[model samples]
Target chain A: MSLSLENVSAGYAGRPVLSGLDLAEVPSGSIVALVGANGAGKSTLLRGIAGLGEAKGRIVLDGQDISELPPEMLVGRIGYLPQALPQGSSLIAYEAVMSAVRAARPDSPRAGGAAAIEQVFDTLGLRDLAMRRLRELSGGQRQMVGLAQVLVRKPRLLLLDEPTSALDLRWQLTVLETVRRMADAEGAICVIAIHDINLALRFCDRLVVLGGGGVLSSGPPATALDADVLRRAYGIEARVEACSRGFAIVLADHALSLDHHSP
Target chain B: MTRHLTALQERSASLADLYGGFIRNRLIAIGLLAVGLACSLVLDVATGPSGLPVADILTGLLDRDALPRGQAVILWNIRLPYAVMAVLVGAALGLAGAEMQTVLNNPLASPFTLGVSAAATLGAALAMALEPDVPGLDETWLIPLSAFACAMAATLLIQTLAGRFGAGTDTVVLFGIAMLFAMNALLWLVQYVASTDALQQMVFWTMGSLARATWEKVAVVALVLAACVPLSMRSVWAMTALRGGDDHARSFGIPVERLRLRVLLRVSLLSAAAVAFVGTIGFIGLVGPHIARLTLGEDHRFYLPGSALAGALLLSLASIASKNLVPGLILPVGIVTSLVGIPLFMALILTQGRRP
Candidate 1:
């Protein structure tokens, strides 16, 4: 399976935030990081692909045109986790994930609902919290449950918008590791819109840096995110170094002089 | 290690029990509500002004020729239709209230409480004042017919505006309030222009009563509620999604606007049929859903039906109270419901606060 975006122009309401943007073909068994500044349209790109916002262009997933497909047809094939989670929902974690699964396939019986739900709980290490209501959980737990809702759908194309923004460091790595394993094992295409460039460079198989409204650079992270590209994507003077672990790391020195340069 | 394994087994056993217990509790609560509503209906019919015995009423209903003319009229025409209408209209308001709250994502969003019933009353008042000289329109039917039509018009108007611009829970609430004020002013204008007899009739309509529950009116309201409940049930999953929030619900492919619009139509049908029949009876619609939430939790499948049953029980009980409270002088059922619904509402709040 593969996913690609071509000539994708989209925005909220009528104003175009991203225009004529083209992304490289993202194949299965790979996790892609969409790294961009706050207003660089990373979330918009994902929402556009998910048909959440007004978008004009082609989003081909596994050789099928997603934008042309009806919403019911696209569901269960593509799942999106928005950045914000609803607060004070009294739904238990197990029920919340089950609702998402049923939303994906409304009329089918869950053959083994209890075991399947328990499997998801164990996979996410949420066994203890499974019975806890959403309102009772902490922010990080809520974020994990939000991700679990998306994963339980078993969608082929997963679009996660800052899913770990509220998570702690341990849970953040755990979530990213679980998502990476899901992609590799299921041959699913996963696109994560992340703010941390270092996390992106470390875990992502491929990185697509965004700026203004178009793709700035995209390739293997070590080559894609040089100091100059870092300065362009984010207004920060940074250094990319290969650590002893045989992967690249970004070390930010200071904020770049916006007076002379444009990010 | 042996103890730990037993602990795991116990945990799994409890988890399995959770679902069984949840289902059982909801079913049992609904059953109890049904039984209570039945009792209230029977007691209400038996305790009317003429004091017909329960056995006599049943015998009269079973065989009209077995009883005298006055008893037959009281059982079939007056008390029987009145009690049955209470259940039907109560269920309508209850179901309407539950669906409206879920779709709008606000606990306080009910047609009766939000001035929809008042708007319908204003419509009925207009119908009375104009007494439209159209052929084929009976004098007795004009008020309710106009009330149902105008209630639907107000609902569509509010829903259309909310769909276009002010679609959020808060915005829709404000729109409902604005609508309430406009309808009340229109009603006052009708009163100012009407003669003495018309004004007195309008005042009584505002108070609300089941004295006008004819077989035809009850049938119309019952049919409307029957149709509306199933239609609302068809979208039960989508409504559950909505309780989390519109954007969250939309992420799962639930069309938020379309779902809201559909539920709004069902709400309009149920509430219009109800308030048109018995003037502005607001408390049951508001309190019924709250009772349902307290007893059945928030799953729309159980909550919707539970609310209908609760509403039926509340209104029927209120009917009985309206009869026995003042003895010979039966206060308006609307007044009795408020007098009863408020204390019950406070009790629910106190109990819920103790839970979490």
Candidate 2:
């Protein structure tokens, strides 16, 4: 079960956001990191894959064309954790997760559904606050609740947009680790758009660096974090060094003046 | 480790426990409605221009032949229809109010807030002012038919105007208010042109009375509510998703605009039917749903039916209270509802404000 994007072009209205973007097949059961600057079309690429945007060209899921499928139908096969978590009024934590489970399977038996959703809550360590209302939860706790809904169905393809952007340091590591475990254990293909290079290097198996609405480099962390690629994509001079666990790209200075002098 | 496992078990059970919780809440609400309805029936029979004892009222209801002709006329012709009309109209308003609030995604949204009742009133006024002088035209059917038409028109107009301004709550409320003013002005025009007797009739209509609730009128209102309530319930999942927000609902396969339009139409029909027969009964739509939510929480499946039942009970109780206010001098049913509903709603708002 792999997802392939072939010559995919998409945009809002008539203005192009991602143009002629080509990528090799994304293998299942791997944590693939999509790293790009703001407005580099990282989010748009994810949205296009999730069938939440208009795009030209084929998005084949498990070798099946799914470009024309509506979001609801595609939702059953793909789970998307949107940038903003939904705020339900007066809904307790347990009720909120159960509602999402019901949405995915409205006719499932009560006991079975309860057990399945409970597995997610237990995994996320959200059981302690299950009876509390959403408004009562802290920001990190709320994000966990949001994550529980996405994982409840154990979807094949998971699309997460900046899942750690709103979290504290503790929650950020917790969520990234959870995503990695989910991909490994459930054989789910995970694509996360992340800003923290260190976090991605630690968790992601492969990194696809996007710039100017296209893939600039795609390989292991060491090759993807080369000085030239980092300088070209983010306009930063970076020293790529090896670590015991993985490679790290350390930002030295702005690479803008280097471009001017070289030309 | 054992304590942590136990805690996890408790938390897991909590989410699954809502089904039982929702059922228990609904049962309590239904029980309260039953008690209120019984009290209404007893009060309706006991108090009138001619007062009777509780025993006599029960005897009359159980064995109609035992009652005297005039008492029979009052019981069967006037009181019965009045009580039935109150229940039906209250149920309609309550259901419509709940539906509107869910669809509009605003706690303040109601049929009256959207100027539905005012539009119905304008239609009733037009019917009175333009009474056909033809020999066979009946005045009784004129108000209801015209009111239904006008209400539907108002619903379509509001949708179109709201669409133009973007379908946000603020824009919808503003458009509704503007329509209310425009309709009220039209109503005043009708009053100005009407004869003295006709003008008095119009004023009485505006005050909202169950005095005119005949068997035929009760049947119409009941039929409308019966159709509207079931239809509205079909959107329970969509409405529940809607509570999450528009984007959430859309992601769940609900076509938000189409669902909104369907709910708006049903609410408009319900409101128009209630107002056409009973005049502009206000606070039942506003207060009844709020009471239901206080008891049933915000889940629409429970909230919608709970609101309908509570509305019926509240309206019937109000009608009974108005009848008993002055034994020989009957106040309009609307007065009793407002007198009871306003303070109750204010208290709810105040209490909710104090909470997180």
Candidate 3:
């Protein structure tokens, strides 16, 4: 499936944060990273696409304009994980994921539920926490469970906002790696609003740099990320240099004056 | 690749086993609570002013001919209705409290938080103070009917206000609290200007006794509770998802706004019916859900019924204590409920290794 955005504008309380923005087709089986400085509408863009907040634009999925589709219509087709992880639930991780599955797919037969939930638990390595209460789990652990709740549904489109903000380095790579494998295996389109540029380059097929209330650049990471885009979007003097293994790495030199290039 | 597949299957099976065990434990707790409720019902029926043996109550339940006329009159006419009313009202309040807490996202929220009880009290006070004279309605039915009407009026007011603005949690809770204070002030106003006899009756009504219970009142509350349980069960998964947060539930395509409004409506019906029939039994609605959460976790499949059963059990035991505690004179069941509920609630809180 291909997803595209046309003249998408989104914000809260009648204040437009990202407006008149357009994005090219993001094909199925591709992972695209949304990278920008703070307050650059990375979350607004994702929330707009997810239909969580107020937005005025067309979000087309597979050539069908789904922007006007009610949230119930988008249940099984789209999954969005918010930046804030869930807290204060006494439900265990397994039950929480099961609740997501049951709530999203209310009419589905219950026979396949056990297998689907178990597979997600295995994929996310949350078997040990299946019986542990969410309130007892640490923040990073709860973040993993939150992702598990989303992943268990196997939505055609996955939108993750800051999925790795609470994780350690090991878990950070593990989560990204899992998302990458799932996207390819299931032919799902994954759009992650993330802040870590290098990690985005490492796992994502393309980068969409958002700034100035619109897209600054959009292409393969090797083409879209560079010194100029970084300086313009983030107001940081940075270098996009090739490492010994020929992978792109960003090295920051200094912060430029924010008065000129602030989004 | 085959070995990897086998290992994955094993891991999945083990995880399923663990989940099954957890579910089994919750089911067992539910079963135990049901059994306890049944035992408490029997105990409540037997412990009264005139000592009726448990053996006689059980035998008389199946074979009415077994007991003498006087004993049978006591069992069928007075004790049985009172005990059954206690269970049904407790269950209604318990279920209402569970939904109230879930929708409001507050552990401290109960049916009383919405001002239904206070409204009912005000209605009762007004009835006592004014002594309204209607041709068909009996004096016996006036207080409860008036109380039920006022409680439902309060609910409708909240519903309209929420629909006008938004049924967001903070807004709904704030409105409920505001209604509570307003109703209390109006009730005090009614009580202040009443005669000595009317004032005493108002005080007695607010204390909430099951002494006036009849089989008809018991049946009405039962019907309301029956209708509500299925609706609550239908939203079980969505309610469970909501415990994560509102945004989380909305992510699952569970319309959080509509769900909250619907639950509040159900809570209002249950609370109004309960507090209408049995004065203002406050403790069960608040503590029933807490007991369920502590023992059975937050899976609404178990937790909802668990709350109901817990409420019934707590109220039944309180009924027995009220009858037997001060021999020859039964304290108000509401007074006994607090006396019984607080100690058990504190015990559960202390014994549980963790609090969520």
Write one digit per residue (lDDT tens) for candidate 2, span A1-263. 78887899977656788888776788888888999777777777887776666688888888877856655567677877767654536566666666665654555546237778777878887777776667667666777877787788678888888888878888798888888888888788999998888788778888988886688888777677788887777877777776766557555565576553231
For all candidates, state DockQ relative to the true structure: 0.43, 0.32, 0.63
Itemize residue pairs with steric clashes in candidate 2: none
Q: Where is model 2 more than 4 Å wrong at Cα?
A: A12-16, A37-45, A68-72, A85-88, A104-112, A195-197, A208-220, A226-244, A247-263, B1-26, B133-137, B158-200, B324-328
* Least accurate 10 contiguous residues by lDDT in model 1 chain B: B10-19
Model 3 clash pairs?
none
What is the Cα-based lDDT of residue B306 in candidate 1?
91
Please provide, for model 2 over B97-172, each residue's C-alpha lDDT reduced to its tens digit, 9 standing for 90 to 100. Answer: 9888877767777779878888888888787777766456577878777887797799899888766766665676
Stretches of model 3 off by over 4 angstroms after superposition: A68-71, A256-263, B1-13, B350-356
Per-prediction TM-score: 0.91, 0.86, 0.95
Q: Which candidate comes out best when scored by DockQ?
A: 3
The stretch of ten residues in a row with the least summed lDDT in candidate 3 chain B is B347-356
Model 1 lDDT, full chain set: 0.82
Ranking by TM-score: 3, 1, 2
Mark the regions of model 1 whose C-alpha exceeds 4 Å error after superposition.
Answer: A109-114, A242-244, A255-263, B1-10, B14-17, B53-69, B112-115, B159-175, B350-354
